[model samples]
Target: MRRDATSSARARIGAALLLLLSGSVVAAGEGDWPAFGRDPSNGHHSPLTTIDRSNVARLRPTWIFQSGVTGYFQAEPVIVEGVMYVSTTGNHVAALDAKTGRVLWTYTHKARTEKIFGPPSNRGVAVSEGLVFEATMDGRVIALDAKTGRLVWDQEAVRPEEGETETASALAATLGDKPVQGSSRLGFKMPPLVAEGLVIVGVTGAGYGLHVEDEKGGLDGGSVVGIEGGYGRRGWLAAYDAKTGAERWRWYVTKEDGWEGVFAETTPDGIPLNRDIAAEKAAAEKNRDAWKVGGGSLWMTPAYDPALGLIFLGTGNPAPQNFGLTRPGDNLYTMSLVALDVRTGQLRWHFQQVPHEQWGYDVASPPFLVEATTPDGQVKAVAQASKTGFIYLHERTTGRLLARSEPLITHKNLFAPPSPEGTVVSPGPLGAISWHPVAYDAVSNRAFAQVRHGAATYTIKTVPASGNRPELRYTETSEAKGEPTFSTLTAIDLASGKAVWSKKAGSRLSGGTLSTAGGLVFSGEEDGHLDAHDAGTGEILWRFQCGAGIGGPPVTYAVDGRQYVAVAAGGASFTKASGFGTGDALVVFALPD
Candidate 1:
């Protein structure tokens, strides 16, 4: 009403500038399968049950997107918005339309020349903000625009640096001294995890550096930048700024020679040891890197609990795993579930399953956080089925042991005493549950897990040392020792901590498990059949023999209000022991509509 006031108008303009300049935009809250388990909870259960069991039999393949990345397609496709992301051996990532399976974008990372041991198999992708992330075999973390398949940044996750702590084999003559060879190398592999503005990544192999002797012991320490703080370059956890991809913090499992005294303060004097075994052990471990020799590979995607601000991850089997005698002690963090505070990347607690596991039974599967109604009331806890023939349940908040189950009859090595803490334990080499994802039923408050019941034998052999050789090396071989050769689906009741029912499957190579509101649980048989079972009674409801074999987890989603069941029928790769051929397919099903 008054005459034009320039000062008032200028004030309004200033306010607008402040808002624009701040530019602190909030991230979108839309629900999508950003990571392997959908969310940090590792609850593979999705609310998008549009494709219920009612019409699942009538479902048909709407489309198919060949990844061109062959081998074990163990990866669970992740859908963000409408785009689906998956990976395979070597480093092949393809983005597709969730509805039509149409390829939108694809990225391929070069494989290493010596891509031996295990075939390149990636579980899935992780998304934060607008970037989709992947870790490559050649040791790099790549960031790509989720909407578009464009490279934003990549980093050398590991490298062989001068004087960096490492492990190696030397000539027989040099065995008397330290492990110093004329030449050296380094390596690492494992997908990076993004949480709370930090890109948390783990190294699978040797930390880049030489295994030179330090006062504390063997190559006492190397440079491990970021989380899991340690001196050596190997087996470290690194944190980087999510936006800039810059290093923030680092941690390692070992420290440098001078840091040897650090353990005296923490070691227990009551335990009998030969001299300063704790400090000596620390010194030797300073150079123990797994990537170079294929030891503890962090192959699976980790689970995050946003509410508790913690990250839950499972680690792989120990190196030269076939020979438990060479590497003693419960390898801290190996074949175990580790709880780390999300913000600081500090280790809160760890639970080891198979110490000194000889059969390569790694705790590599995802750990599920189930919120269920117990007999007394309700509780939240961590549930996991290990390859070591046990289903472990722990209080999520305190890592308190609650319950565990030995689902299968297994044999212990009569030759060996109870395995030292970290060596190895196993029902099978991979696991009672490996990379296969399990499903939880909210209605029943039960967790359904598929496990391969059998035993594998392992023995180590000594290899000739041409260059630098560590104290000793081991060779291992494994096969199904004894078994009915049948897989089983177990319904674990969270409240009573008991297996309500367990049904033997037709094949020992069942994929993962899926639960539907239609009172059904679906699993793909190793014998090339997809069977629907009554979730409550564990009775077979229906069976369909797809043309190919089923080796991937089944997913249920709805299209046009019709519930459809989907699963990748590509047979198992990576392991030849399965004797299964590769069958490329993504089978879909719907009830008789």
Candidate 2:
């Protein structure tokens, strides 16, 4: 079907099925973890009470589903009604029976095999009315029939118009006789957030590997295009109509014309050529030449708060992985938390944790929204734990910064001066938090978060400019390596930003955290154990050994008035190289009633 006609298909509505169940609403019925982080709040908190603490010891293995693809199965499943929707590698979406873990339907998109792109791993899927939504590793937005898993529409979201922008080069282009510079070129890869009949999404370009051969013969670099709050393609935030796929609006980050590198061939001066970038044109000739693509993708899901009317999304780091200089100016919003208007795509507020990031401090963790009371006795607000290693508290109503808690880790020579307004700190690039969603408990007004404690040493060097590549150079110092360190889960009092309780795990690299009203906290270890902790005091209560290591989030639900806990023991993907266990198993636990 054509992109315009997809909106008129009323049959798609029939595909959305509303299941009515008297017990626990069937959200935790099978292995389907519907919606990212269960619901938009990114809470990863399940109301299903079937498997409570008393009998949780008796919980046993139920079944397993093999994805047949390897990389990272970081996505959680979504269980709507009695049906579960899950995404495996190779852009495959499967519908399974919640009770028996049986595959009901499947759809797969075969990606190109020969390219050197990142491994194919799925974070999760979203469903609405009768359609299921998913994003591919190669940058495509696909809509599938929710009931049958049939293809509805698949559209490539990143396609830059020719001659739209250019990049920089080496040496100088003279206005009669002087040195000059280059400009920027840009594309996409942020998993989208859907709500109120629209899909809100961002883009990830502008780093290395995204260069194109410029008309000038030399190559230039680019910037991100869909970020609404910044520059380069305006860094627009777009809202596409869910039913019709029409663009609603766009918000740009800034309006300054970008720069490009410049170098001359012969003589003392080059041509007085101006790159087409809106500003800083006279000083450079935009290298609109050959450029590579892909890297710094938005690999996690954003959270939504309908009550507060805001969508929370964290962005990835600047391109080329471990180098700076090529990109500058705090790289606004890259390693920041953005609160956007659900209906307008307007930027409500933002907090950039790492300005001009040198390491991979991606703010990509699902923004866990917690509504709790503060210490002064009369303040109620929301909170989030950033991968940058700080627990940020804000007045959710106004996006006001309340406080931040830095992890207790030793640094060799790192120094981040706190802004006059607040303290600046390094949370480690793996993030004090990653894609694994954390857990929140309203009863105690405390949020549980997991993090790694270590140092990643890297350096950059400029290479000689040549071919259709940009003169601007970036290469990480491989001599600097990462030091192994400890890991743990810390419970923070939202009001005072104080660490109330903490339990040390084996290593900094581990799985997500979960909390419950049952007085339990659930999480995994790099050593392959899924343990349950006391929510308030951080005491180890019980643990189960899985067939593989636990690297995904654990959820709890009630079925027929009995409570159960389910975890994905698939191990780590993007972080750990490959020796870790990568089985496609869903381990369900329960207590003896």
Candidate 3:
């Protein structure tokens, strides 16, 4: 079917399937989680009420599926027909019996290249039409038989990490550092979204900013050293045929019109941005080809709106993330909430949070769809908990701003430019919310966000011209140990744009939130506690020490009329510096049968 004509017909309406049960209209499919956010709305809310606030206290561990893969475990298991399909860090997928902890089948990815150009973390898998689709770290899209773990078709969707090692080696040599071979390239961080007979996937780590080993390295090398002018590659989102793996339509993130807009001095909501207009315009003329390598990677999973045939997602910061001069002019679509036509991959609308992004303020958290009450009664809306520490609510169809909630986290020097010596700023590159999934409960019109409180000192240091190397000056950041930081789980009432309740986490709250119809919100912490909170009061009702940091989202599903809450507890949710224990355990909790 042609995309433009049959798009709406092929799209699945994610609104609940109304099944008349016991003389009442009840939403069905709440017993299983089929996608990362469960449905196309990406609300992360389950309507199963078996484990409500009263009985949730009796929930206990029933089974544990150990992935045995080390490092970050951020997989949100996809459950369907009593089977759980999940992905781990090393591009591995497994099929497990949702009732028992039995491993049915496992598909170990044999990489096209061992060198990971991007983040190796695989969030989860998408299950559609009897096929389990996974976006691998080595830049390939593979589909497995949904029943058995047999390979169906494999396609190299992303270009191989071409010239990545060369770029990393060159930068390392210039800075008297050794280049890590495997860290040069990029990969897919989240699972692909399969909709309308098409599998949509995006590339990660397309930006020039390199990942640093230590906190000190984060300042000096991570984002500060934006060298070689055109080191980054343009990011894109492409859709391919679900069965044959054929390309359908592709959309490039950066604008073709030079990526330089009106050089706006304020954000879309009129917040003053710290930028030098005259200096940037002059620098833009000097580096006229910078837009070719504009940095704007898609970092989070998006929600598809069947009504509008649009996909809403959050794009990362501009390339050379922390530094500003290279690709100027509001950076077009980078660091914004973008709405793209699902069928043709055409840009429908965009709302940029930061223009000429210098502070690494990405619209990092995934945006979810909601039916919000407006002056015109009820309208479909999209809401996001951003790195800017505010919850932005926008009218879905036209991308009009509805409300900007109060800051979920503290903010000090927002949009401040990097200083020579160092200027400390709150909600820095690590972000107020770094790629964490937010949960929304339509019954209460509340959104739960996981926020981190931290600061970074942005310093621009100049290395004098060496014997052969040219003089270079770049912005870097240093760990501000003197400044105290913490994390919190905040609940914002979407209707009034106010925080209804907030609870300070027991430890570093690095995980995502999941709200269920049982009047409960499940979240995890770096200290190995998977906690269940009262959705209305923000009170911790239950806690389970899982022996690893619970950085992933907890999912709830029903098997044989019994409800279960499952989460993966992998060690060190924040970083190794935090000293949180690491492990690979997918813990499932349920009330005694």
TM-score to native of every candidate shown:
0.73, 0.73, 0.92
lDDT of 2 by residue, 1-593 (tens): 24323331221221112111101122323223356665556666544434446655666766566766654555566667666677765567888766567889999776532231334555666777777877665545678888999888766554523112233223222122322221123333334566777766654433322222222322211111111111123234566666666667654432133212222111111212222223323322332211122123344566776756677776665443444323333344555677778788777886655554445666666676765555554443545576656677666666666666655344443433212122222444555577667777654667788876655433333344568744443332211234555677888776666779877886434557776645678888755678888777888778877756675667654444445566666655433322356666666655554
61-143: candidate 1 lDDT, tens digit per residue: 55555655445555566655556677655567777766667778888776544422234455556676788777665556678
Candidate 1 lowest-lDDT run of ten: 220-229
Error of 2 at 77 (Å): 0.8
Highest lDDT: which candidate? Answer: 3
The superposed Cα distance between candidate 2 and the true structure at residue 279, in angstroms, equals 20
Q: Residues 1-593, candidate 3, lDDT per residue (tens digit)?
A: 24422322222223453112111121235477878887777888887777988888899999999887876888889898899999987889999999998999999888777677533577888887788988887888888998899999998876675437344454555555522222325578776787677888887776645544554322222333454356666778888888898889988888878588889989989989978998888888776766667778787788887667788998877776677877667888888899998889999999998888877777778889987888889988999888878989999888999988988777878878888878888887766877888998876799998888888788876767766666665666655658867788889999888889889887878668999877899988989999899998989999999998886888999988899999988864434566677788899999988
Candidate 1, residue 448: lDDT: 83
- Between 2 and 3, whose TM-score is larger? 3
List candidate 3 segments past 4 Å from native: 1-28, 163-167, 174-184, 215-225, 572-574
Cα shift from native, residue 183, model 3 (Å): 5.9
Q: Give residue 339's lDDT in candidate 1 (0 to 100).
A: 81
| lDDT (0 to 1) per candidate | 0.55, 0.53, 0.78
How close to the true structure is residue 310 of candidate 3, measured as C-alpha lDDT?
84
Q: Best TM-score goes to which candidate?
A: 3
Off by over 4 Å in 2: 1-34, 112-117, 159-192, 204-237, 250-297, 320-322, 372-380, 406-408, 415-427, 464-472, 475-484, 507-511, 575-578, 591-593
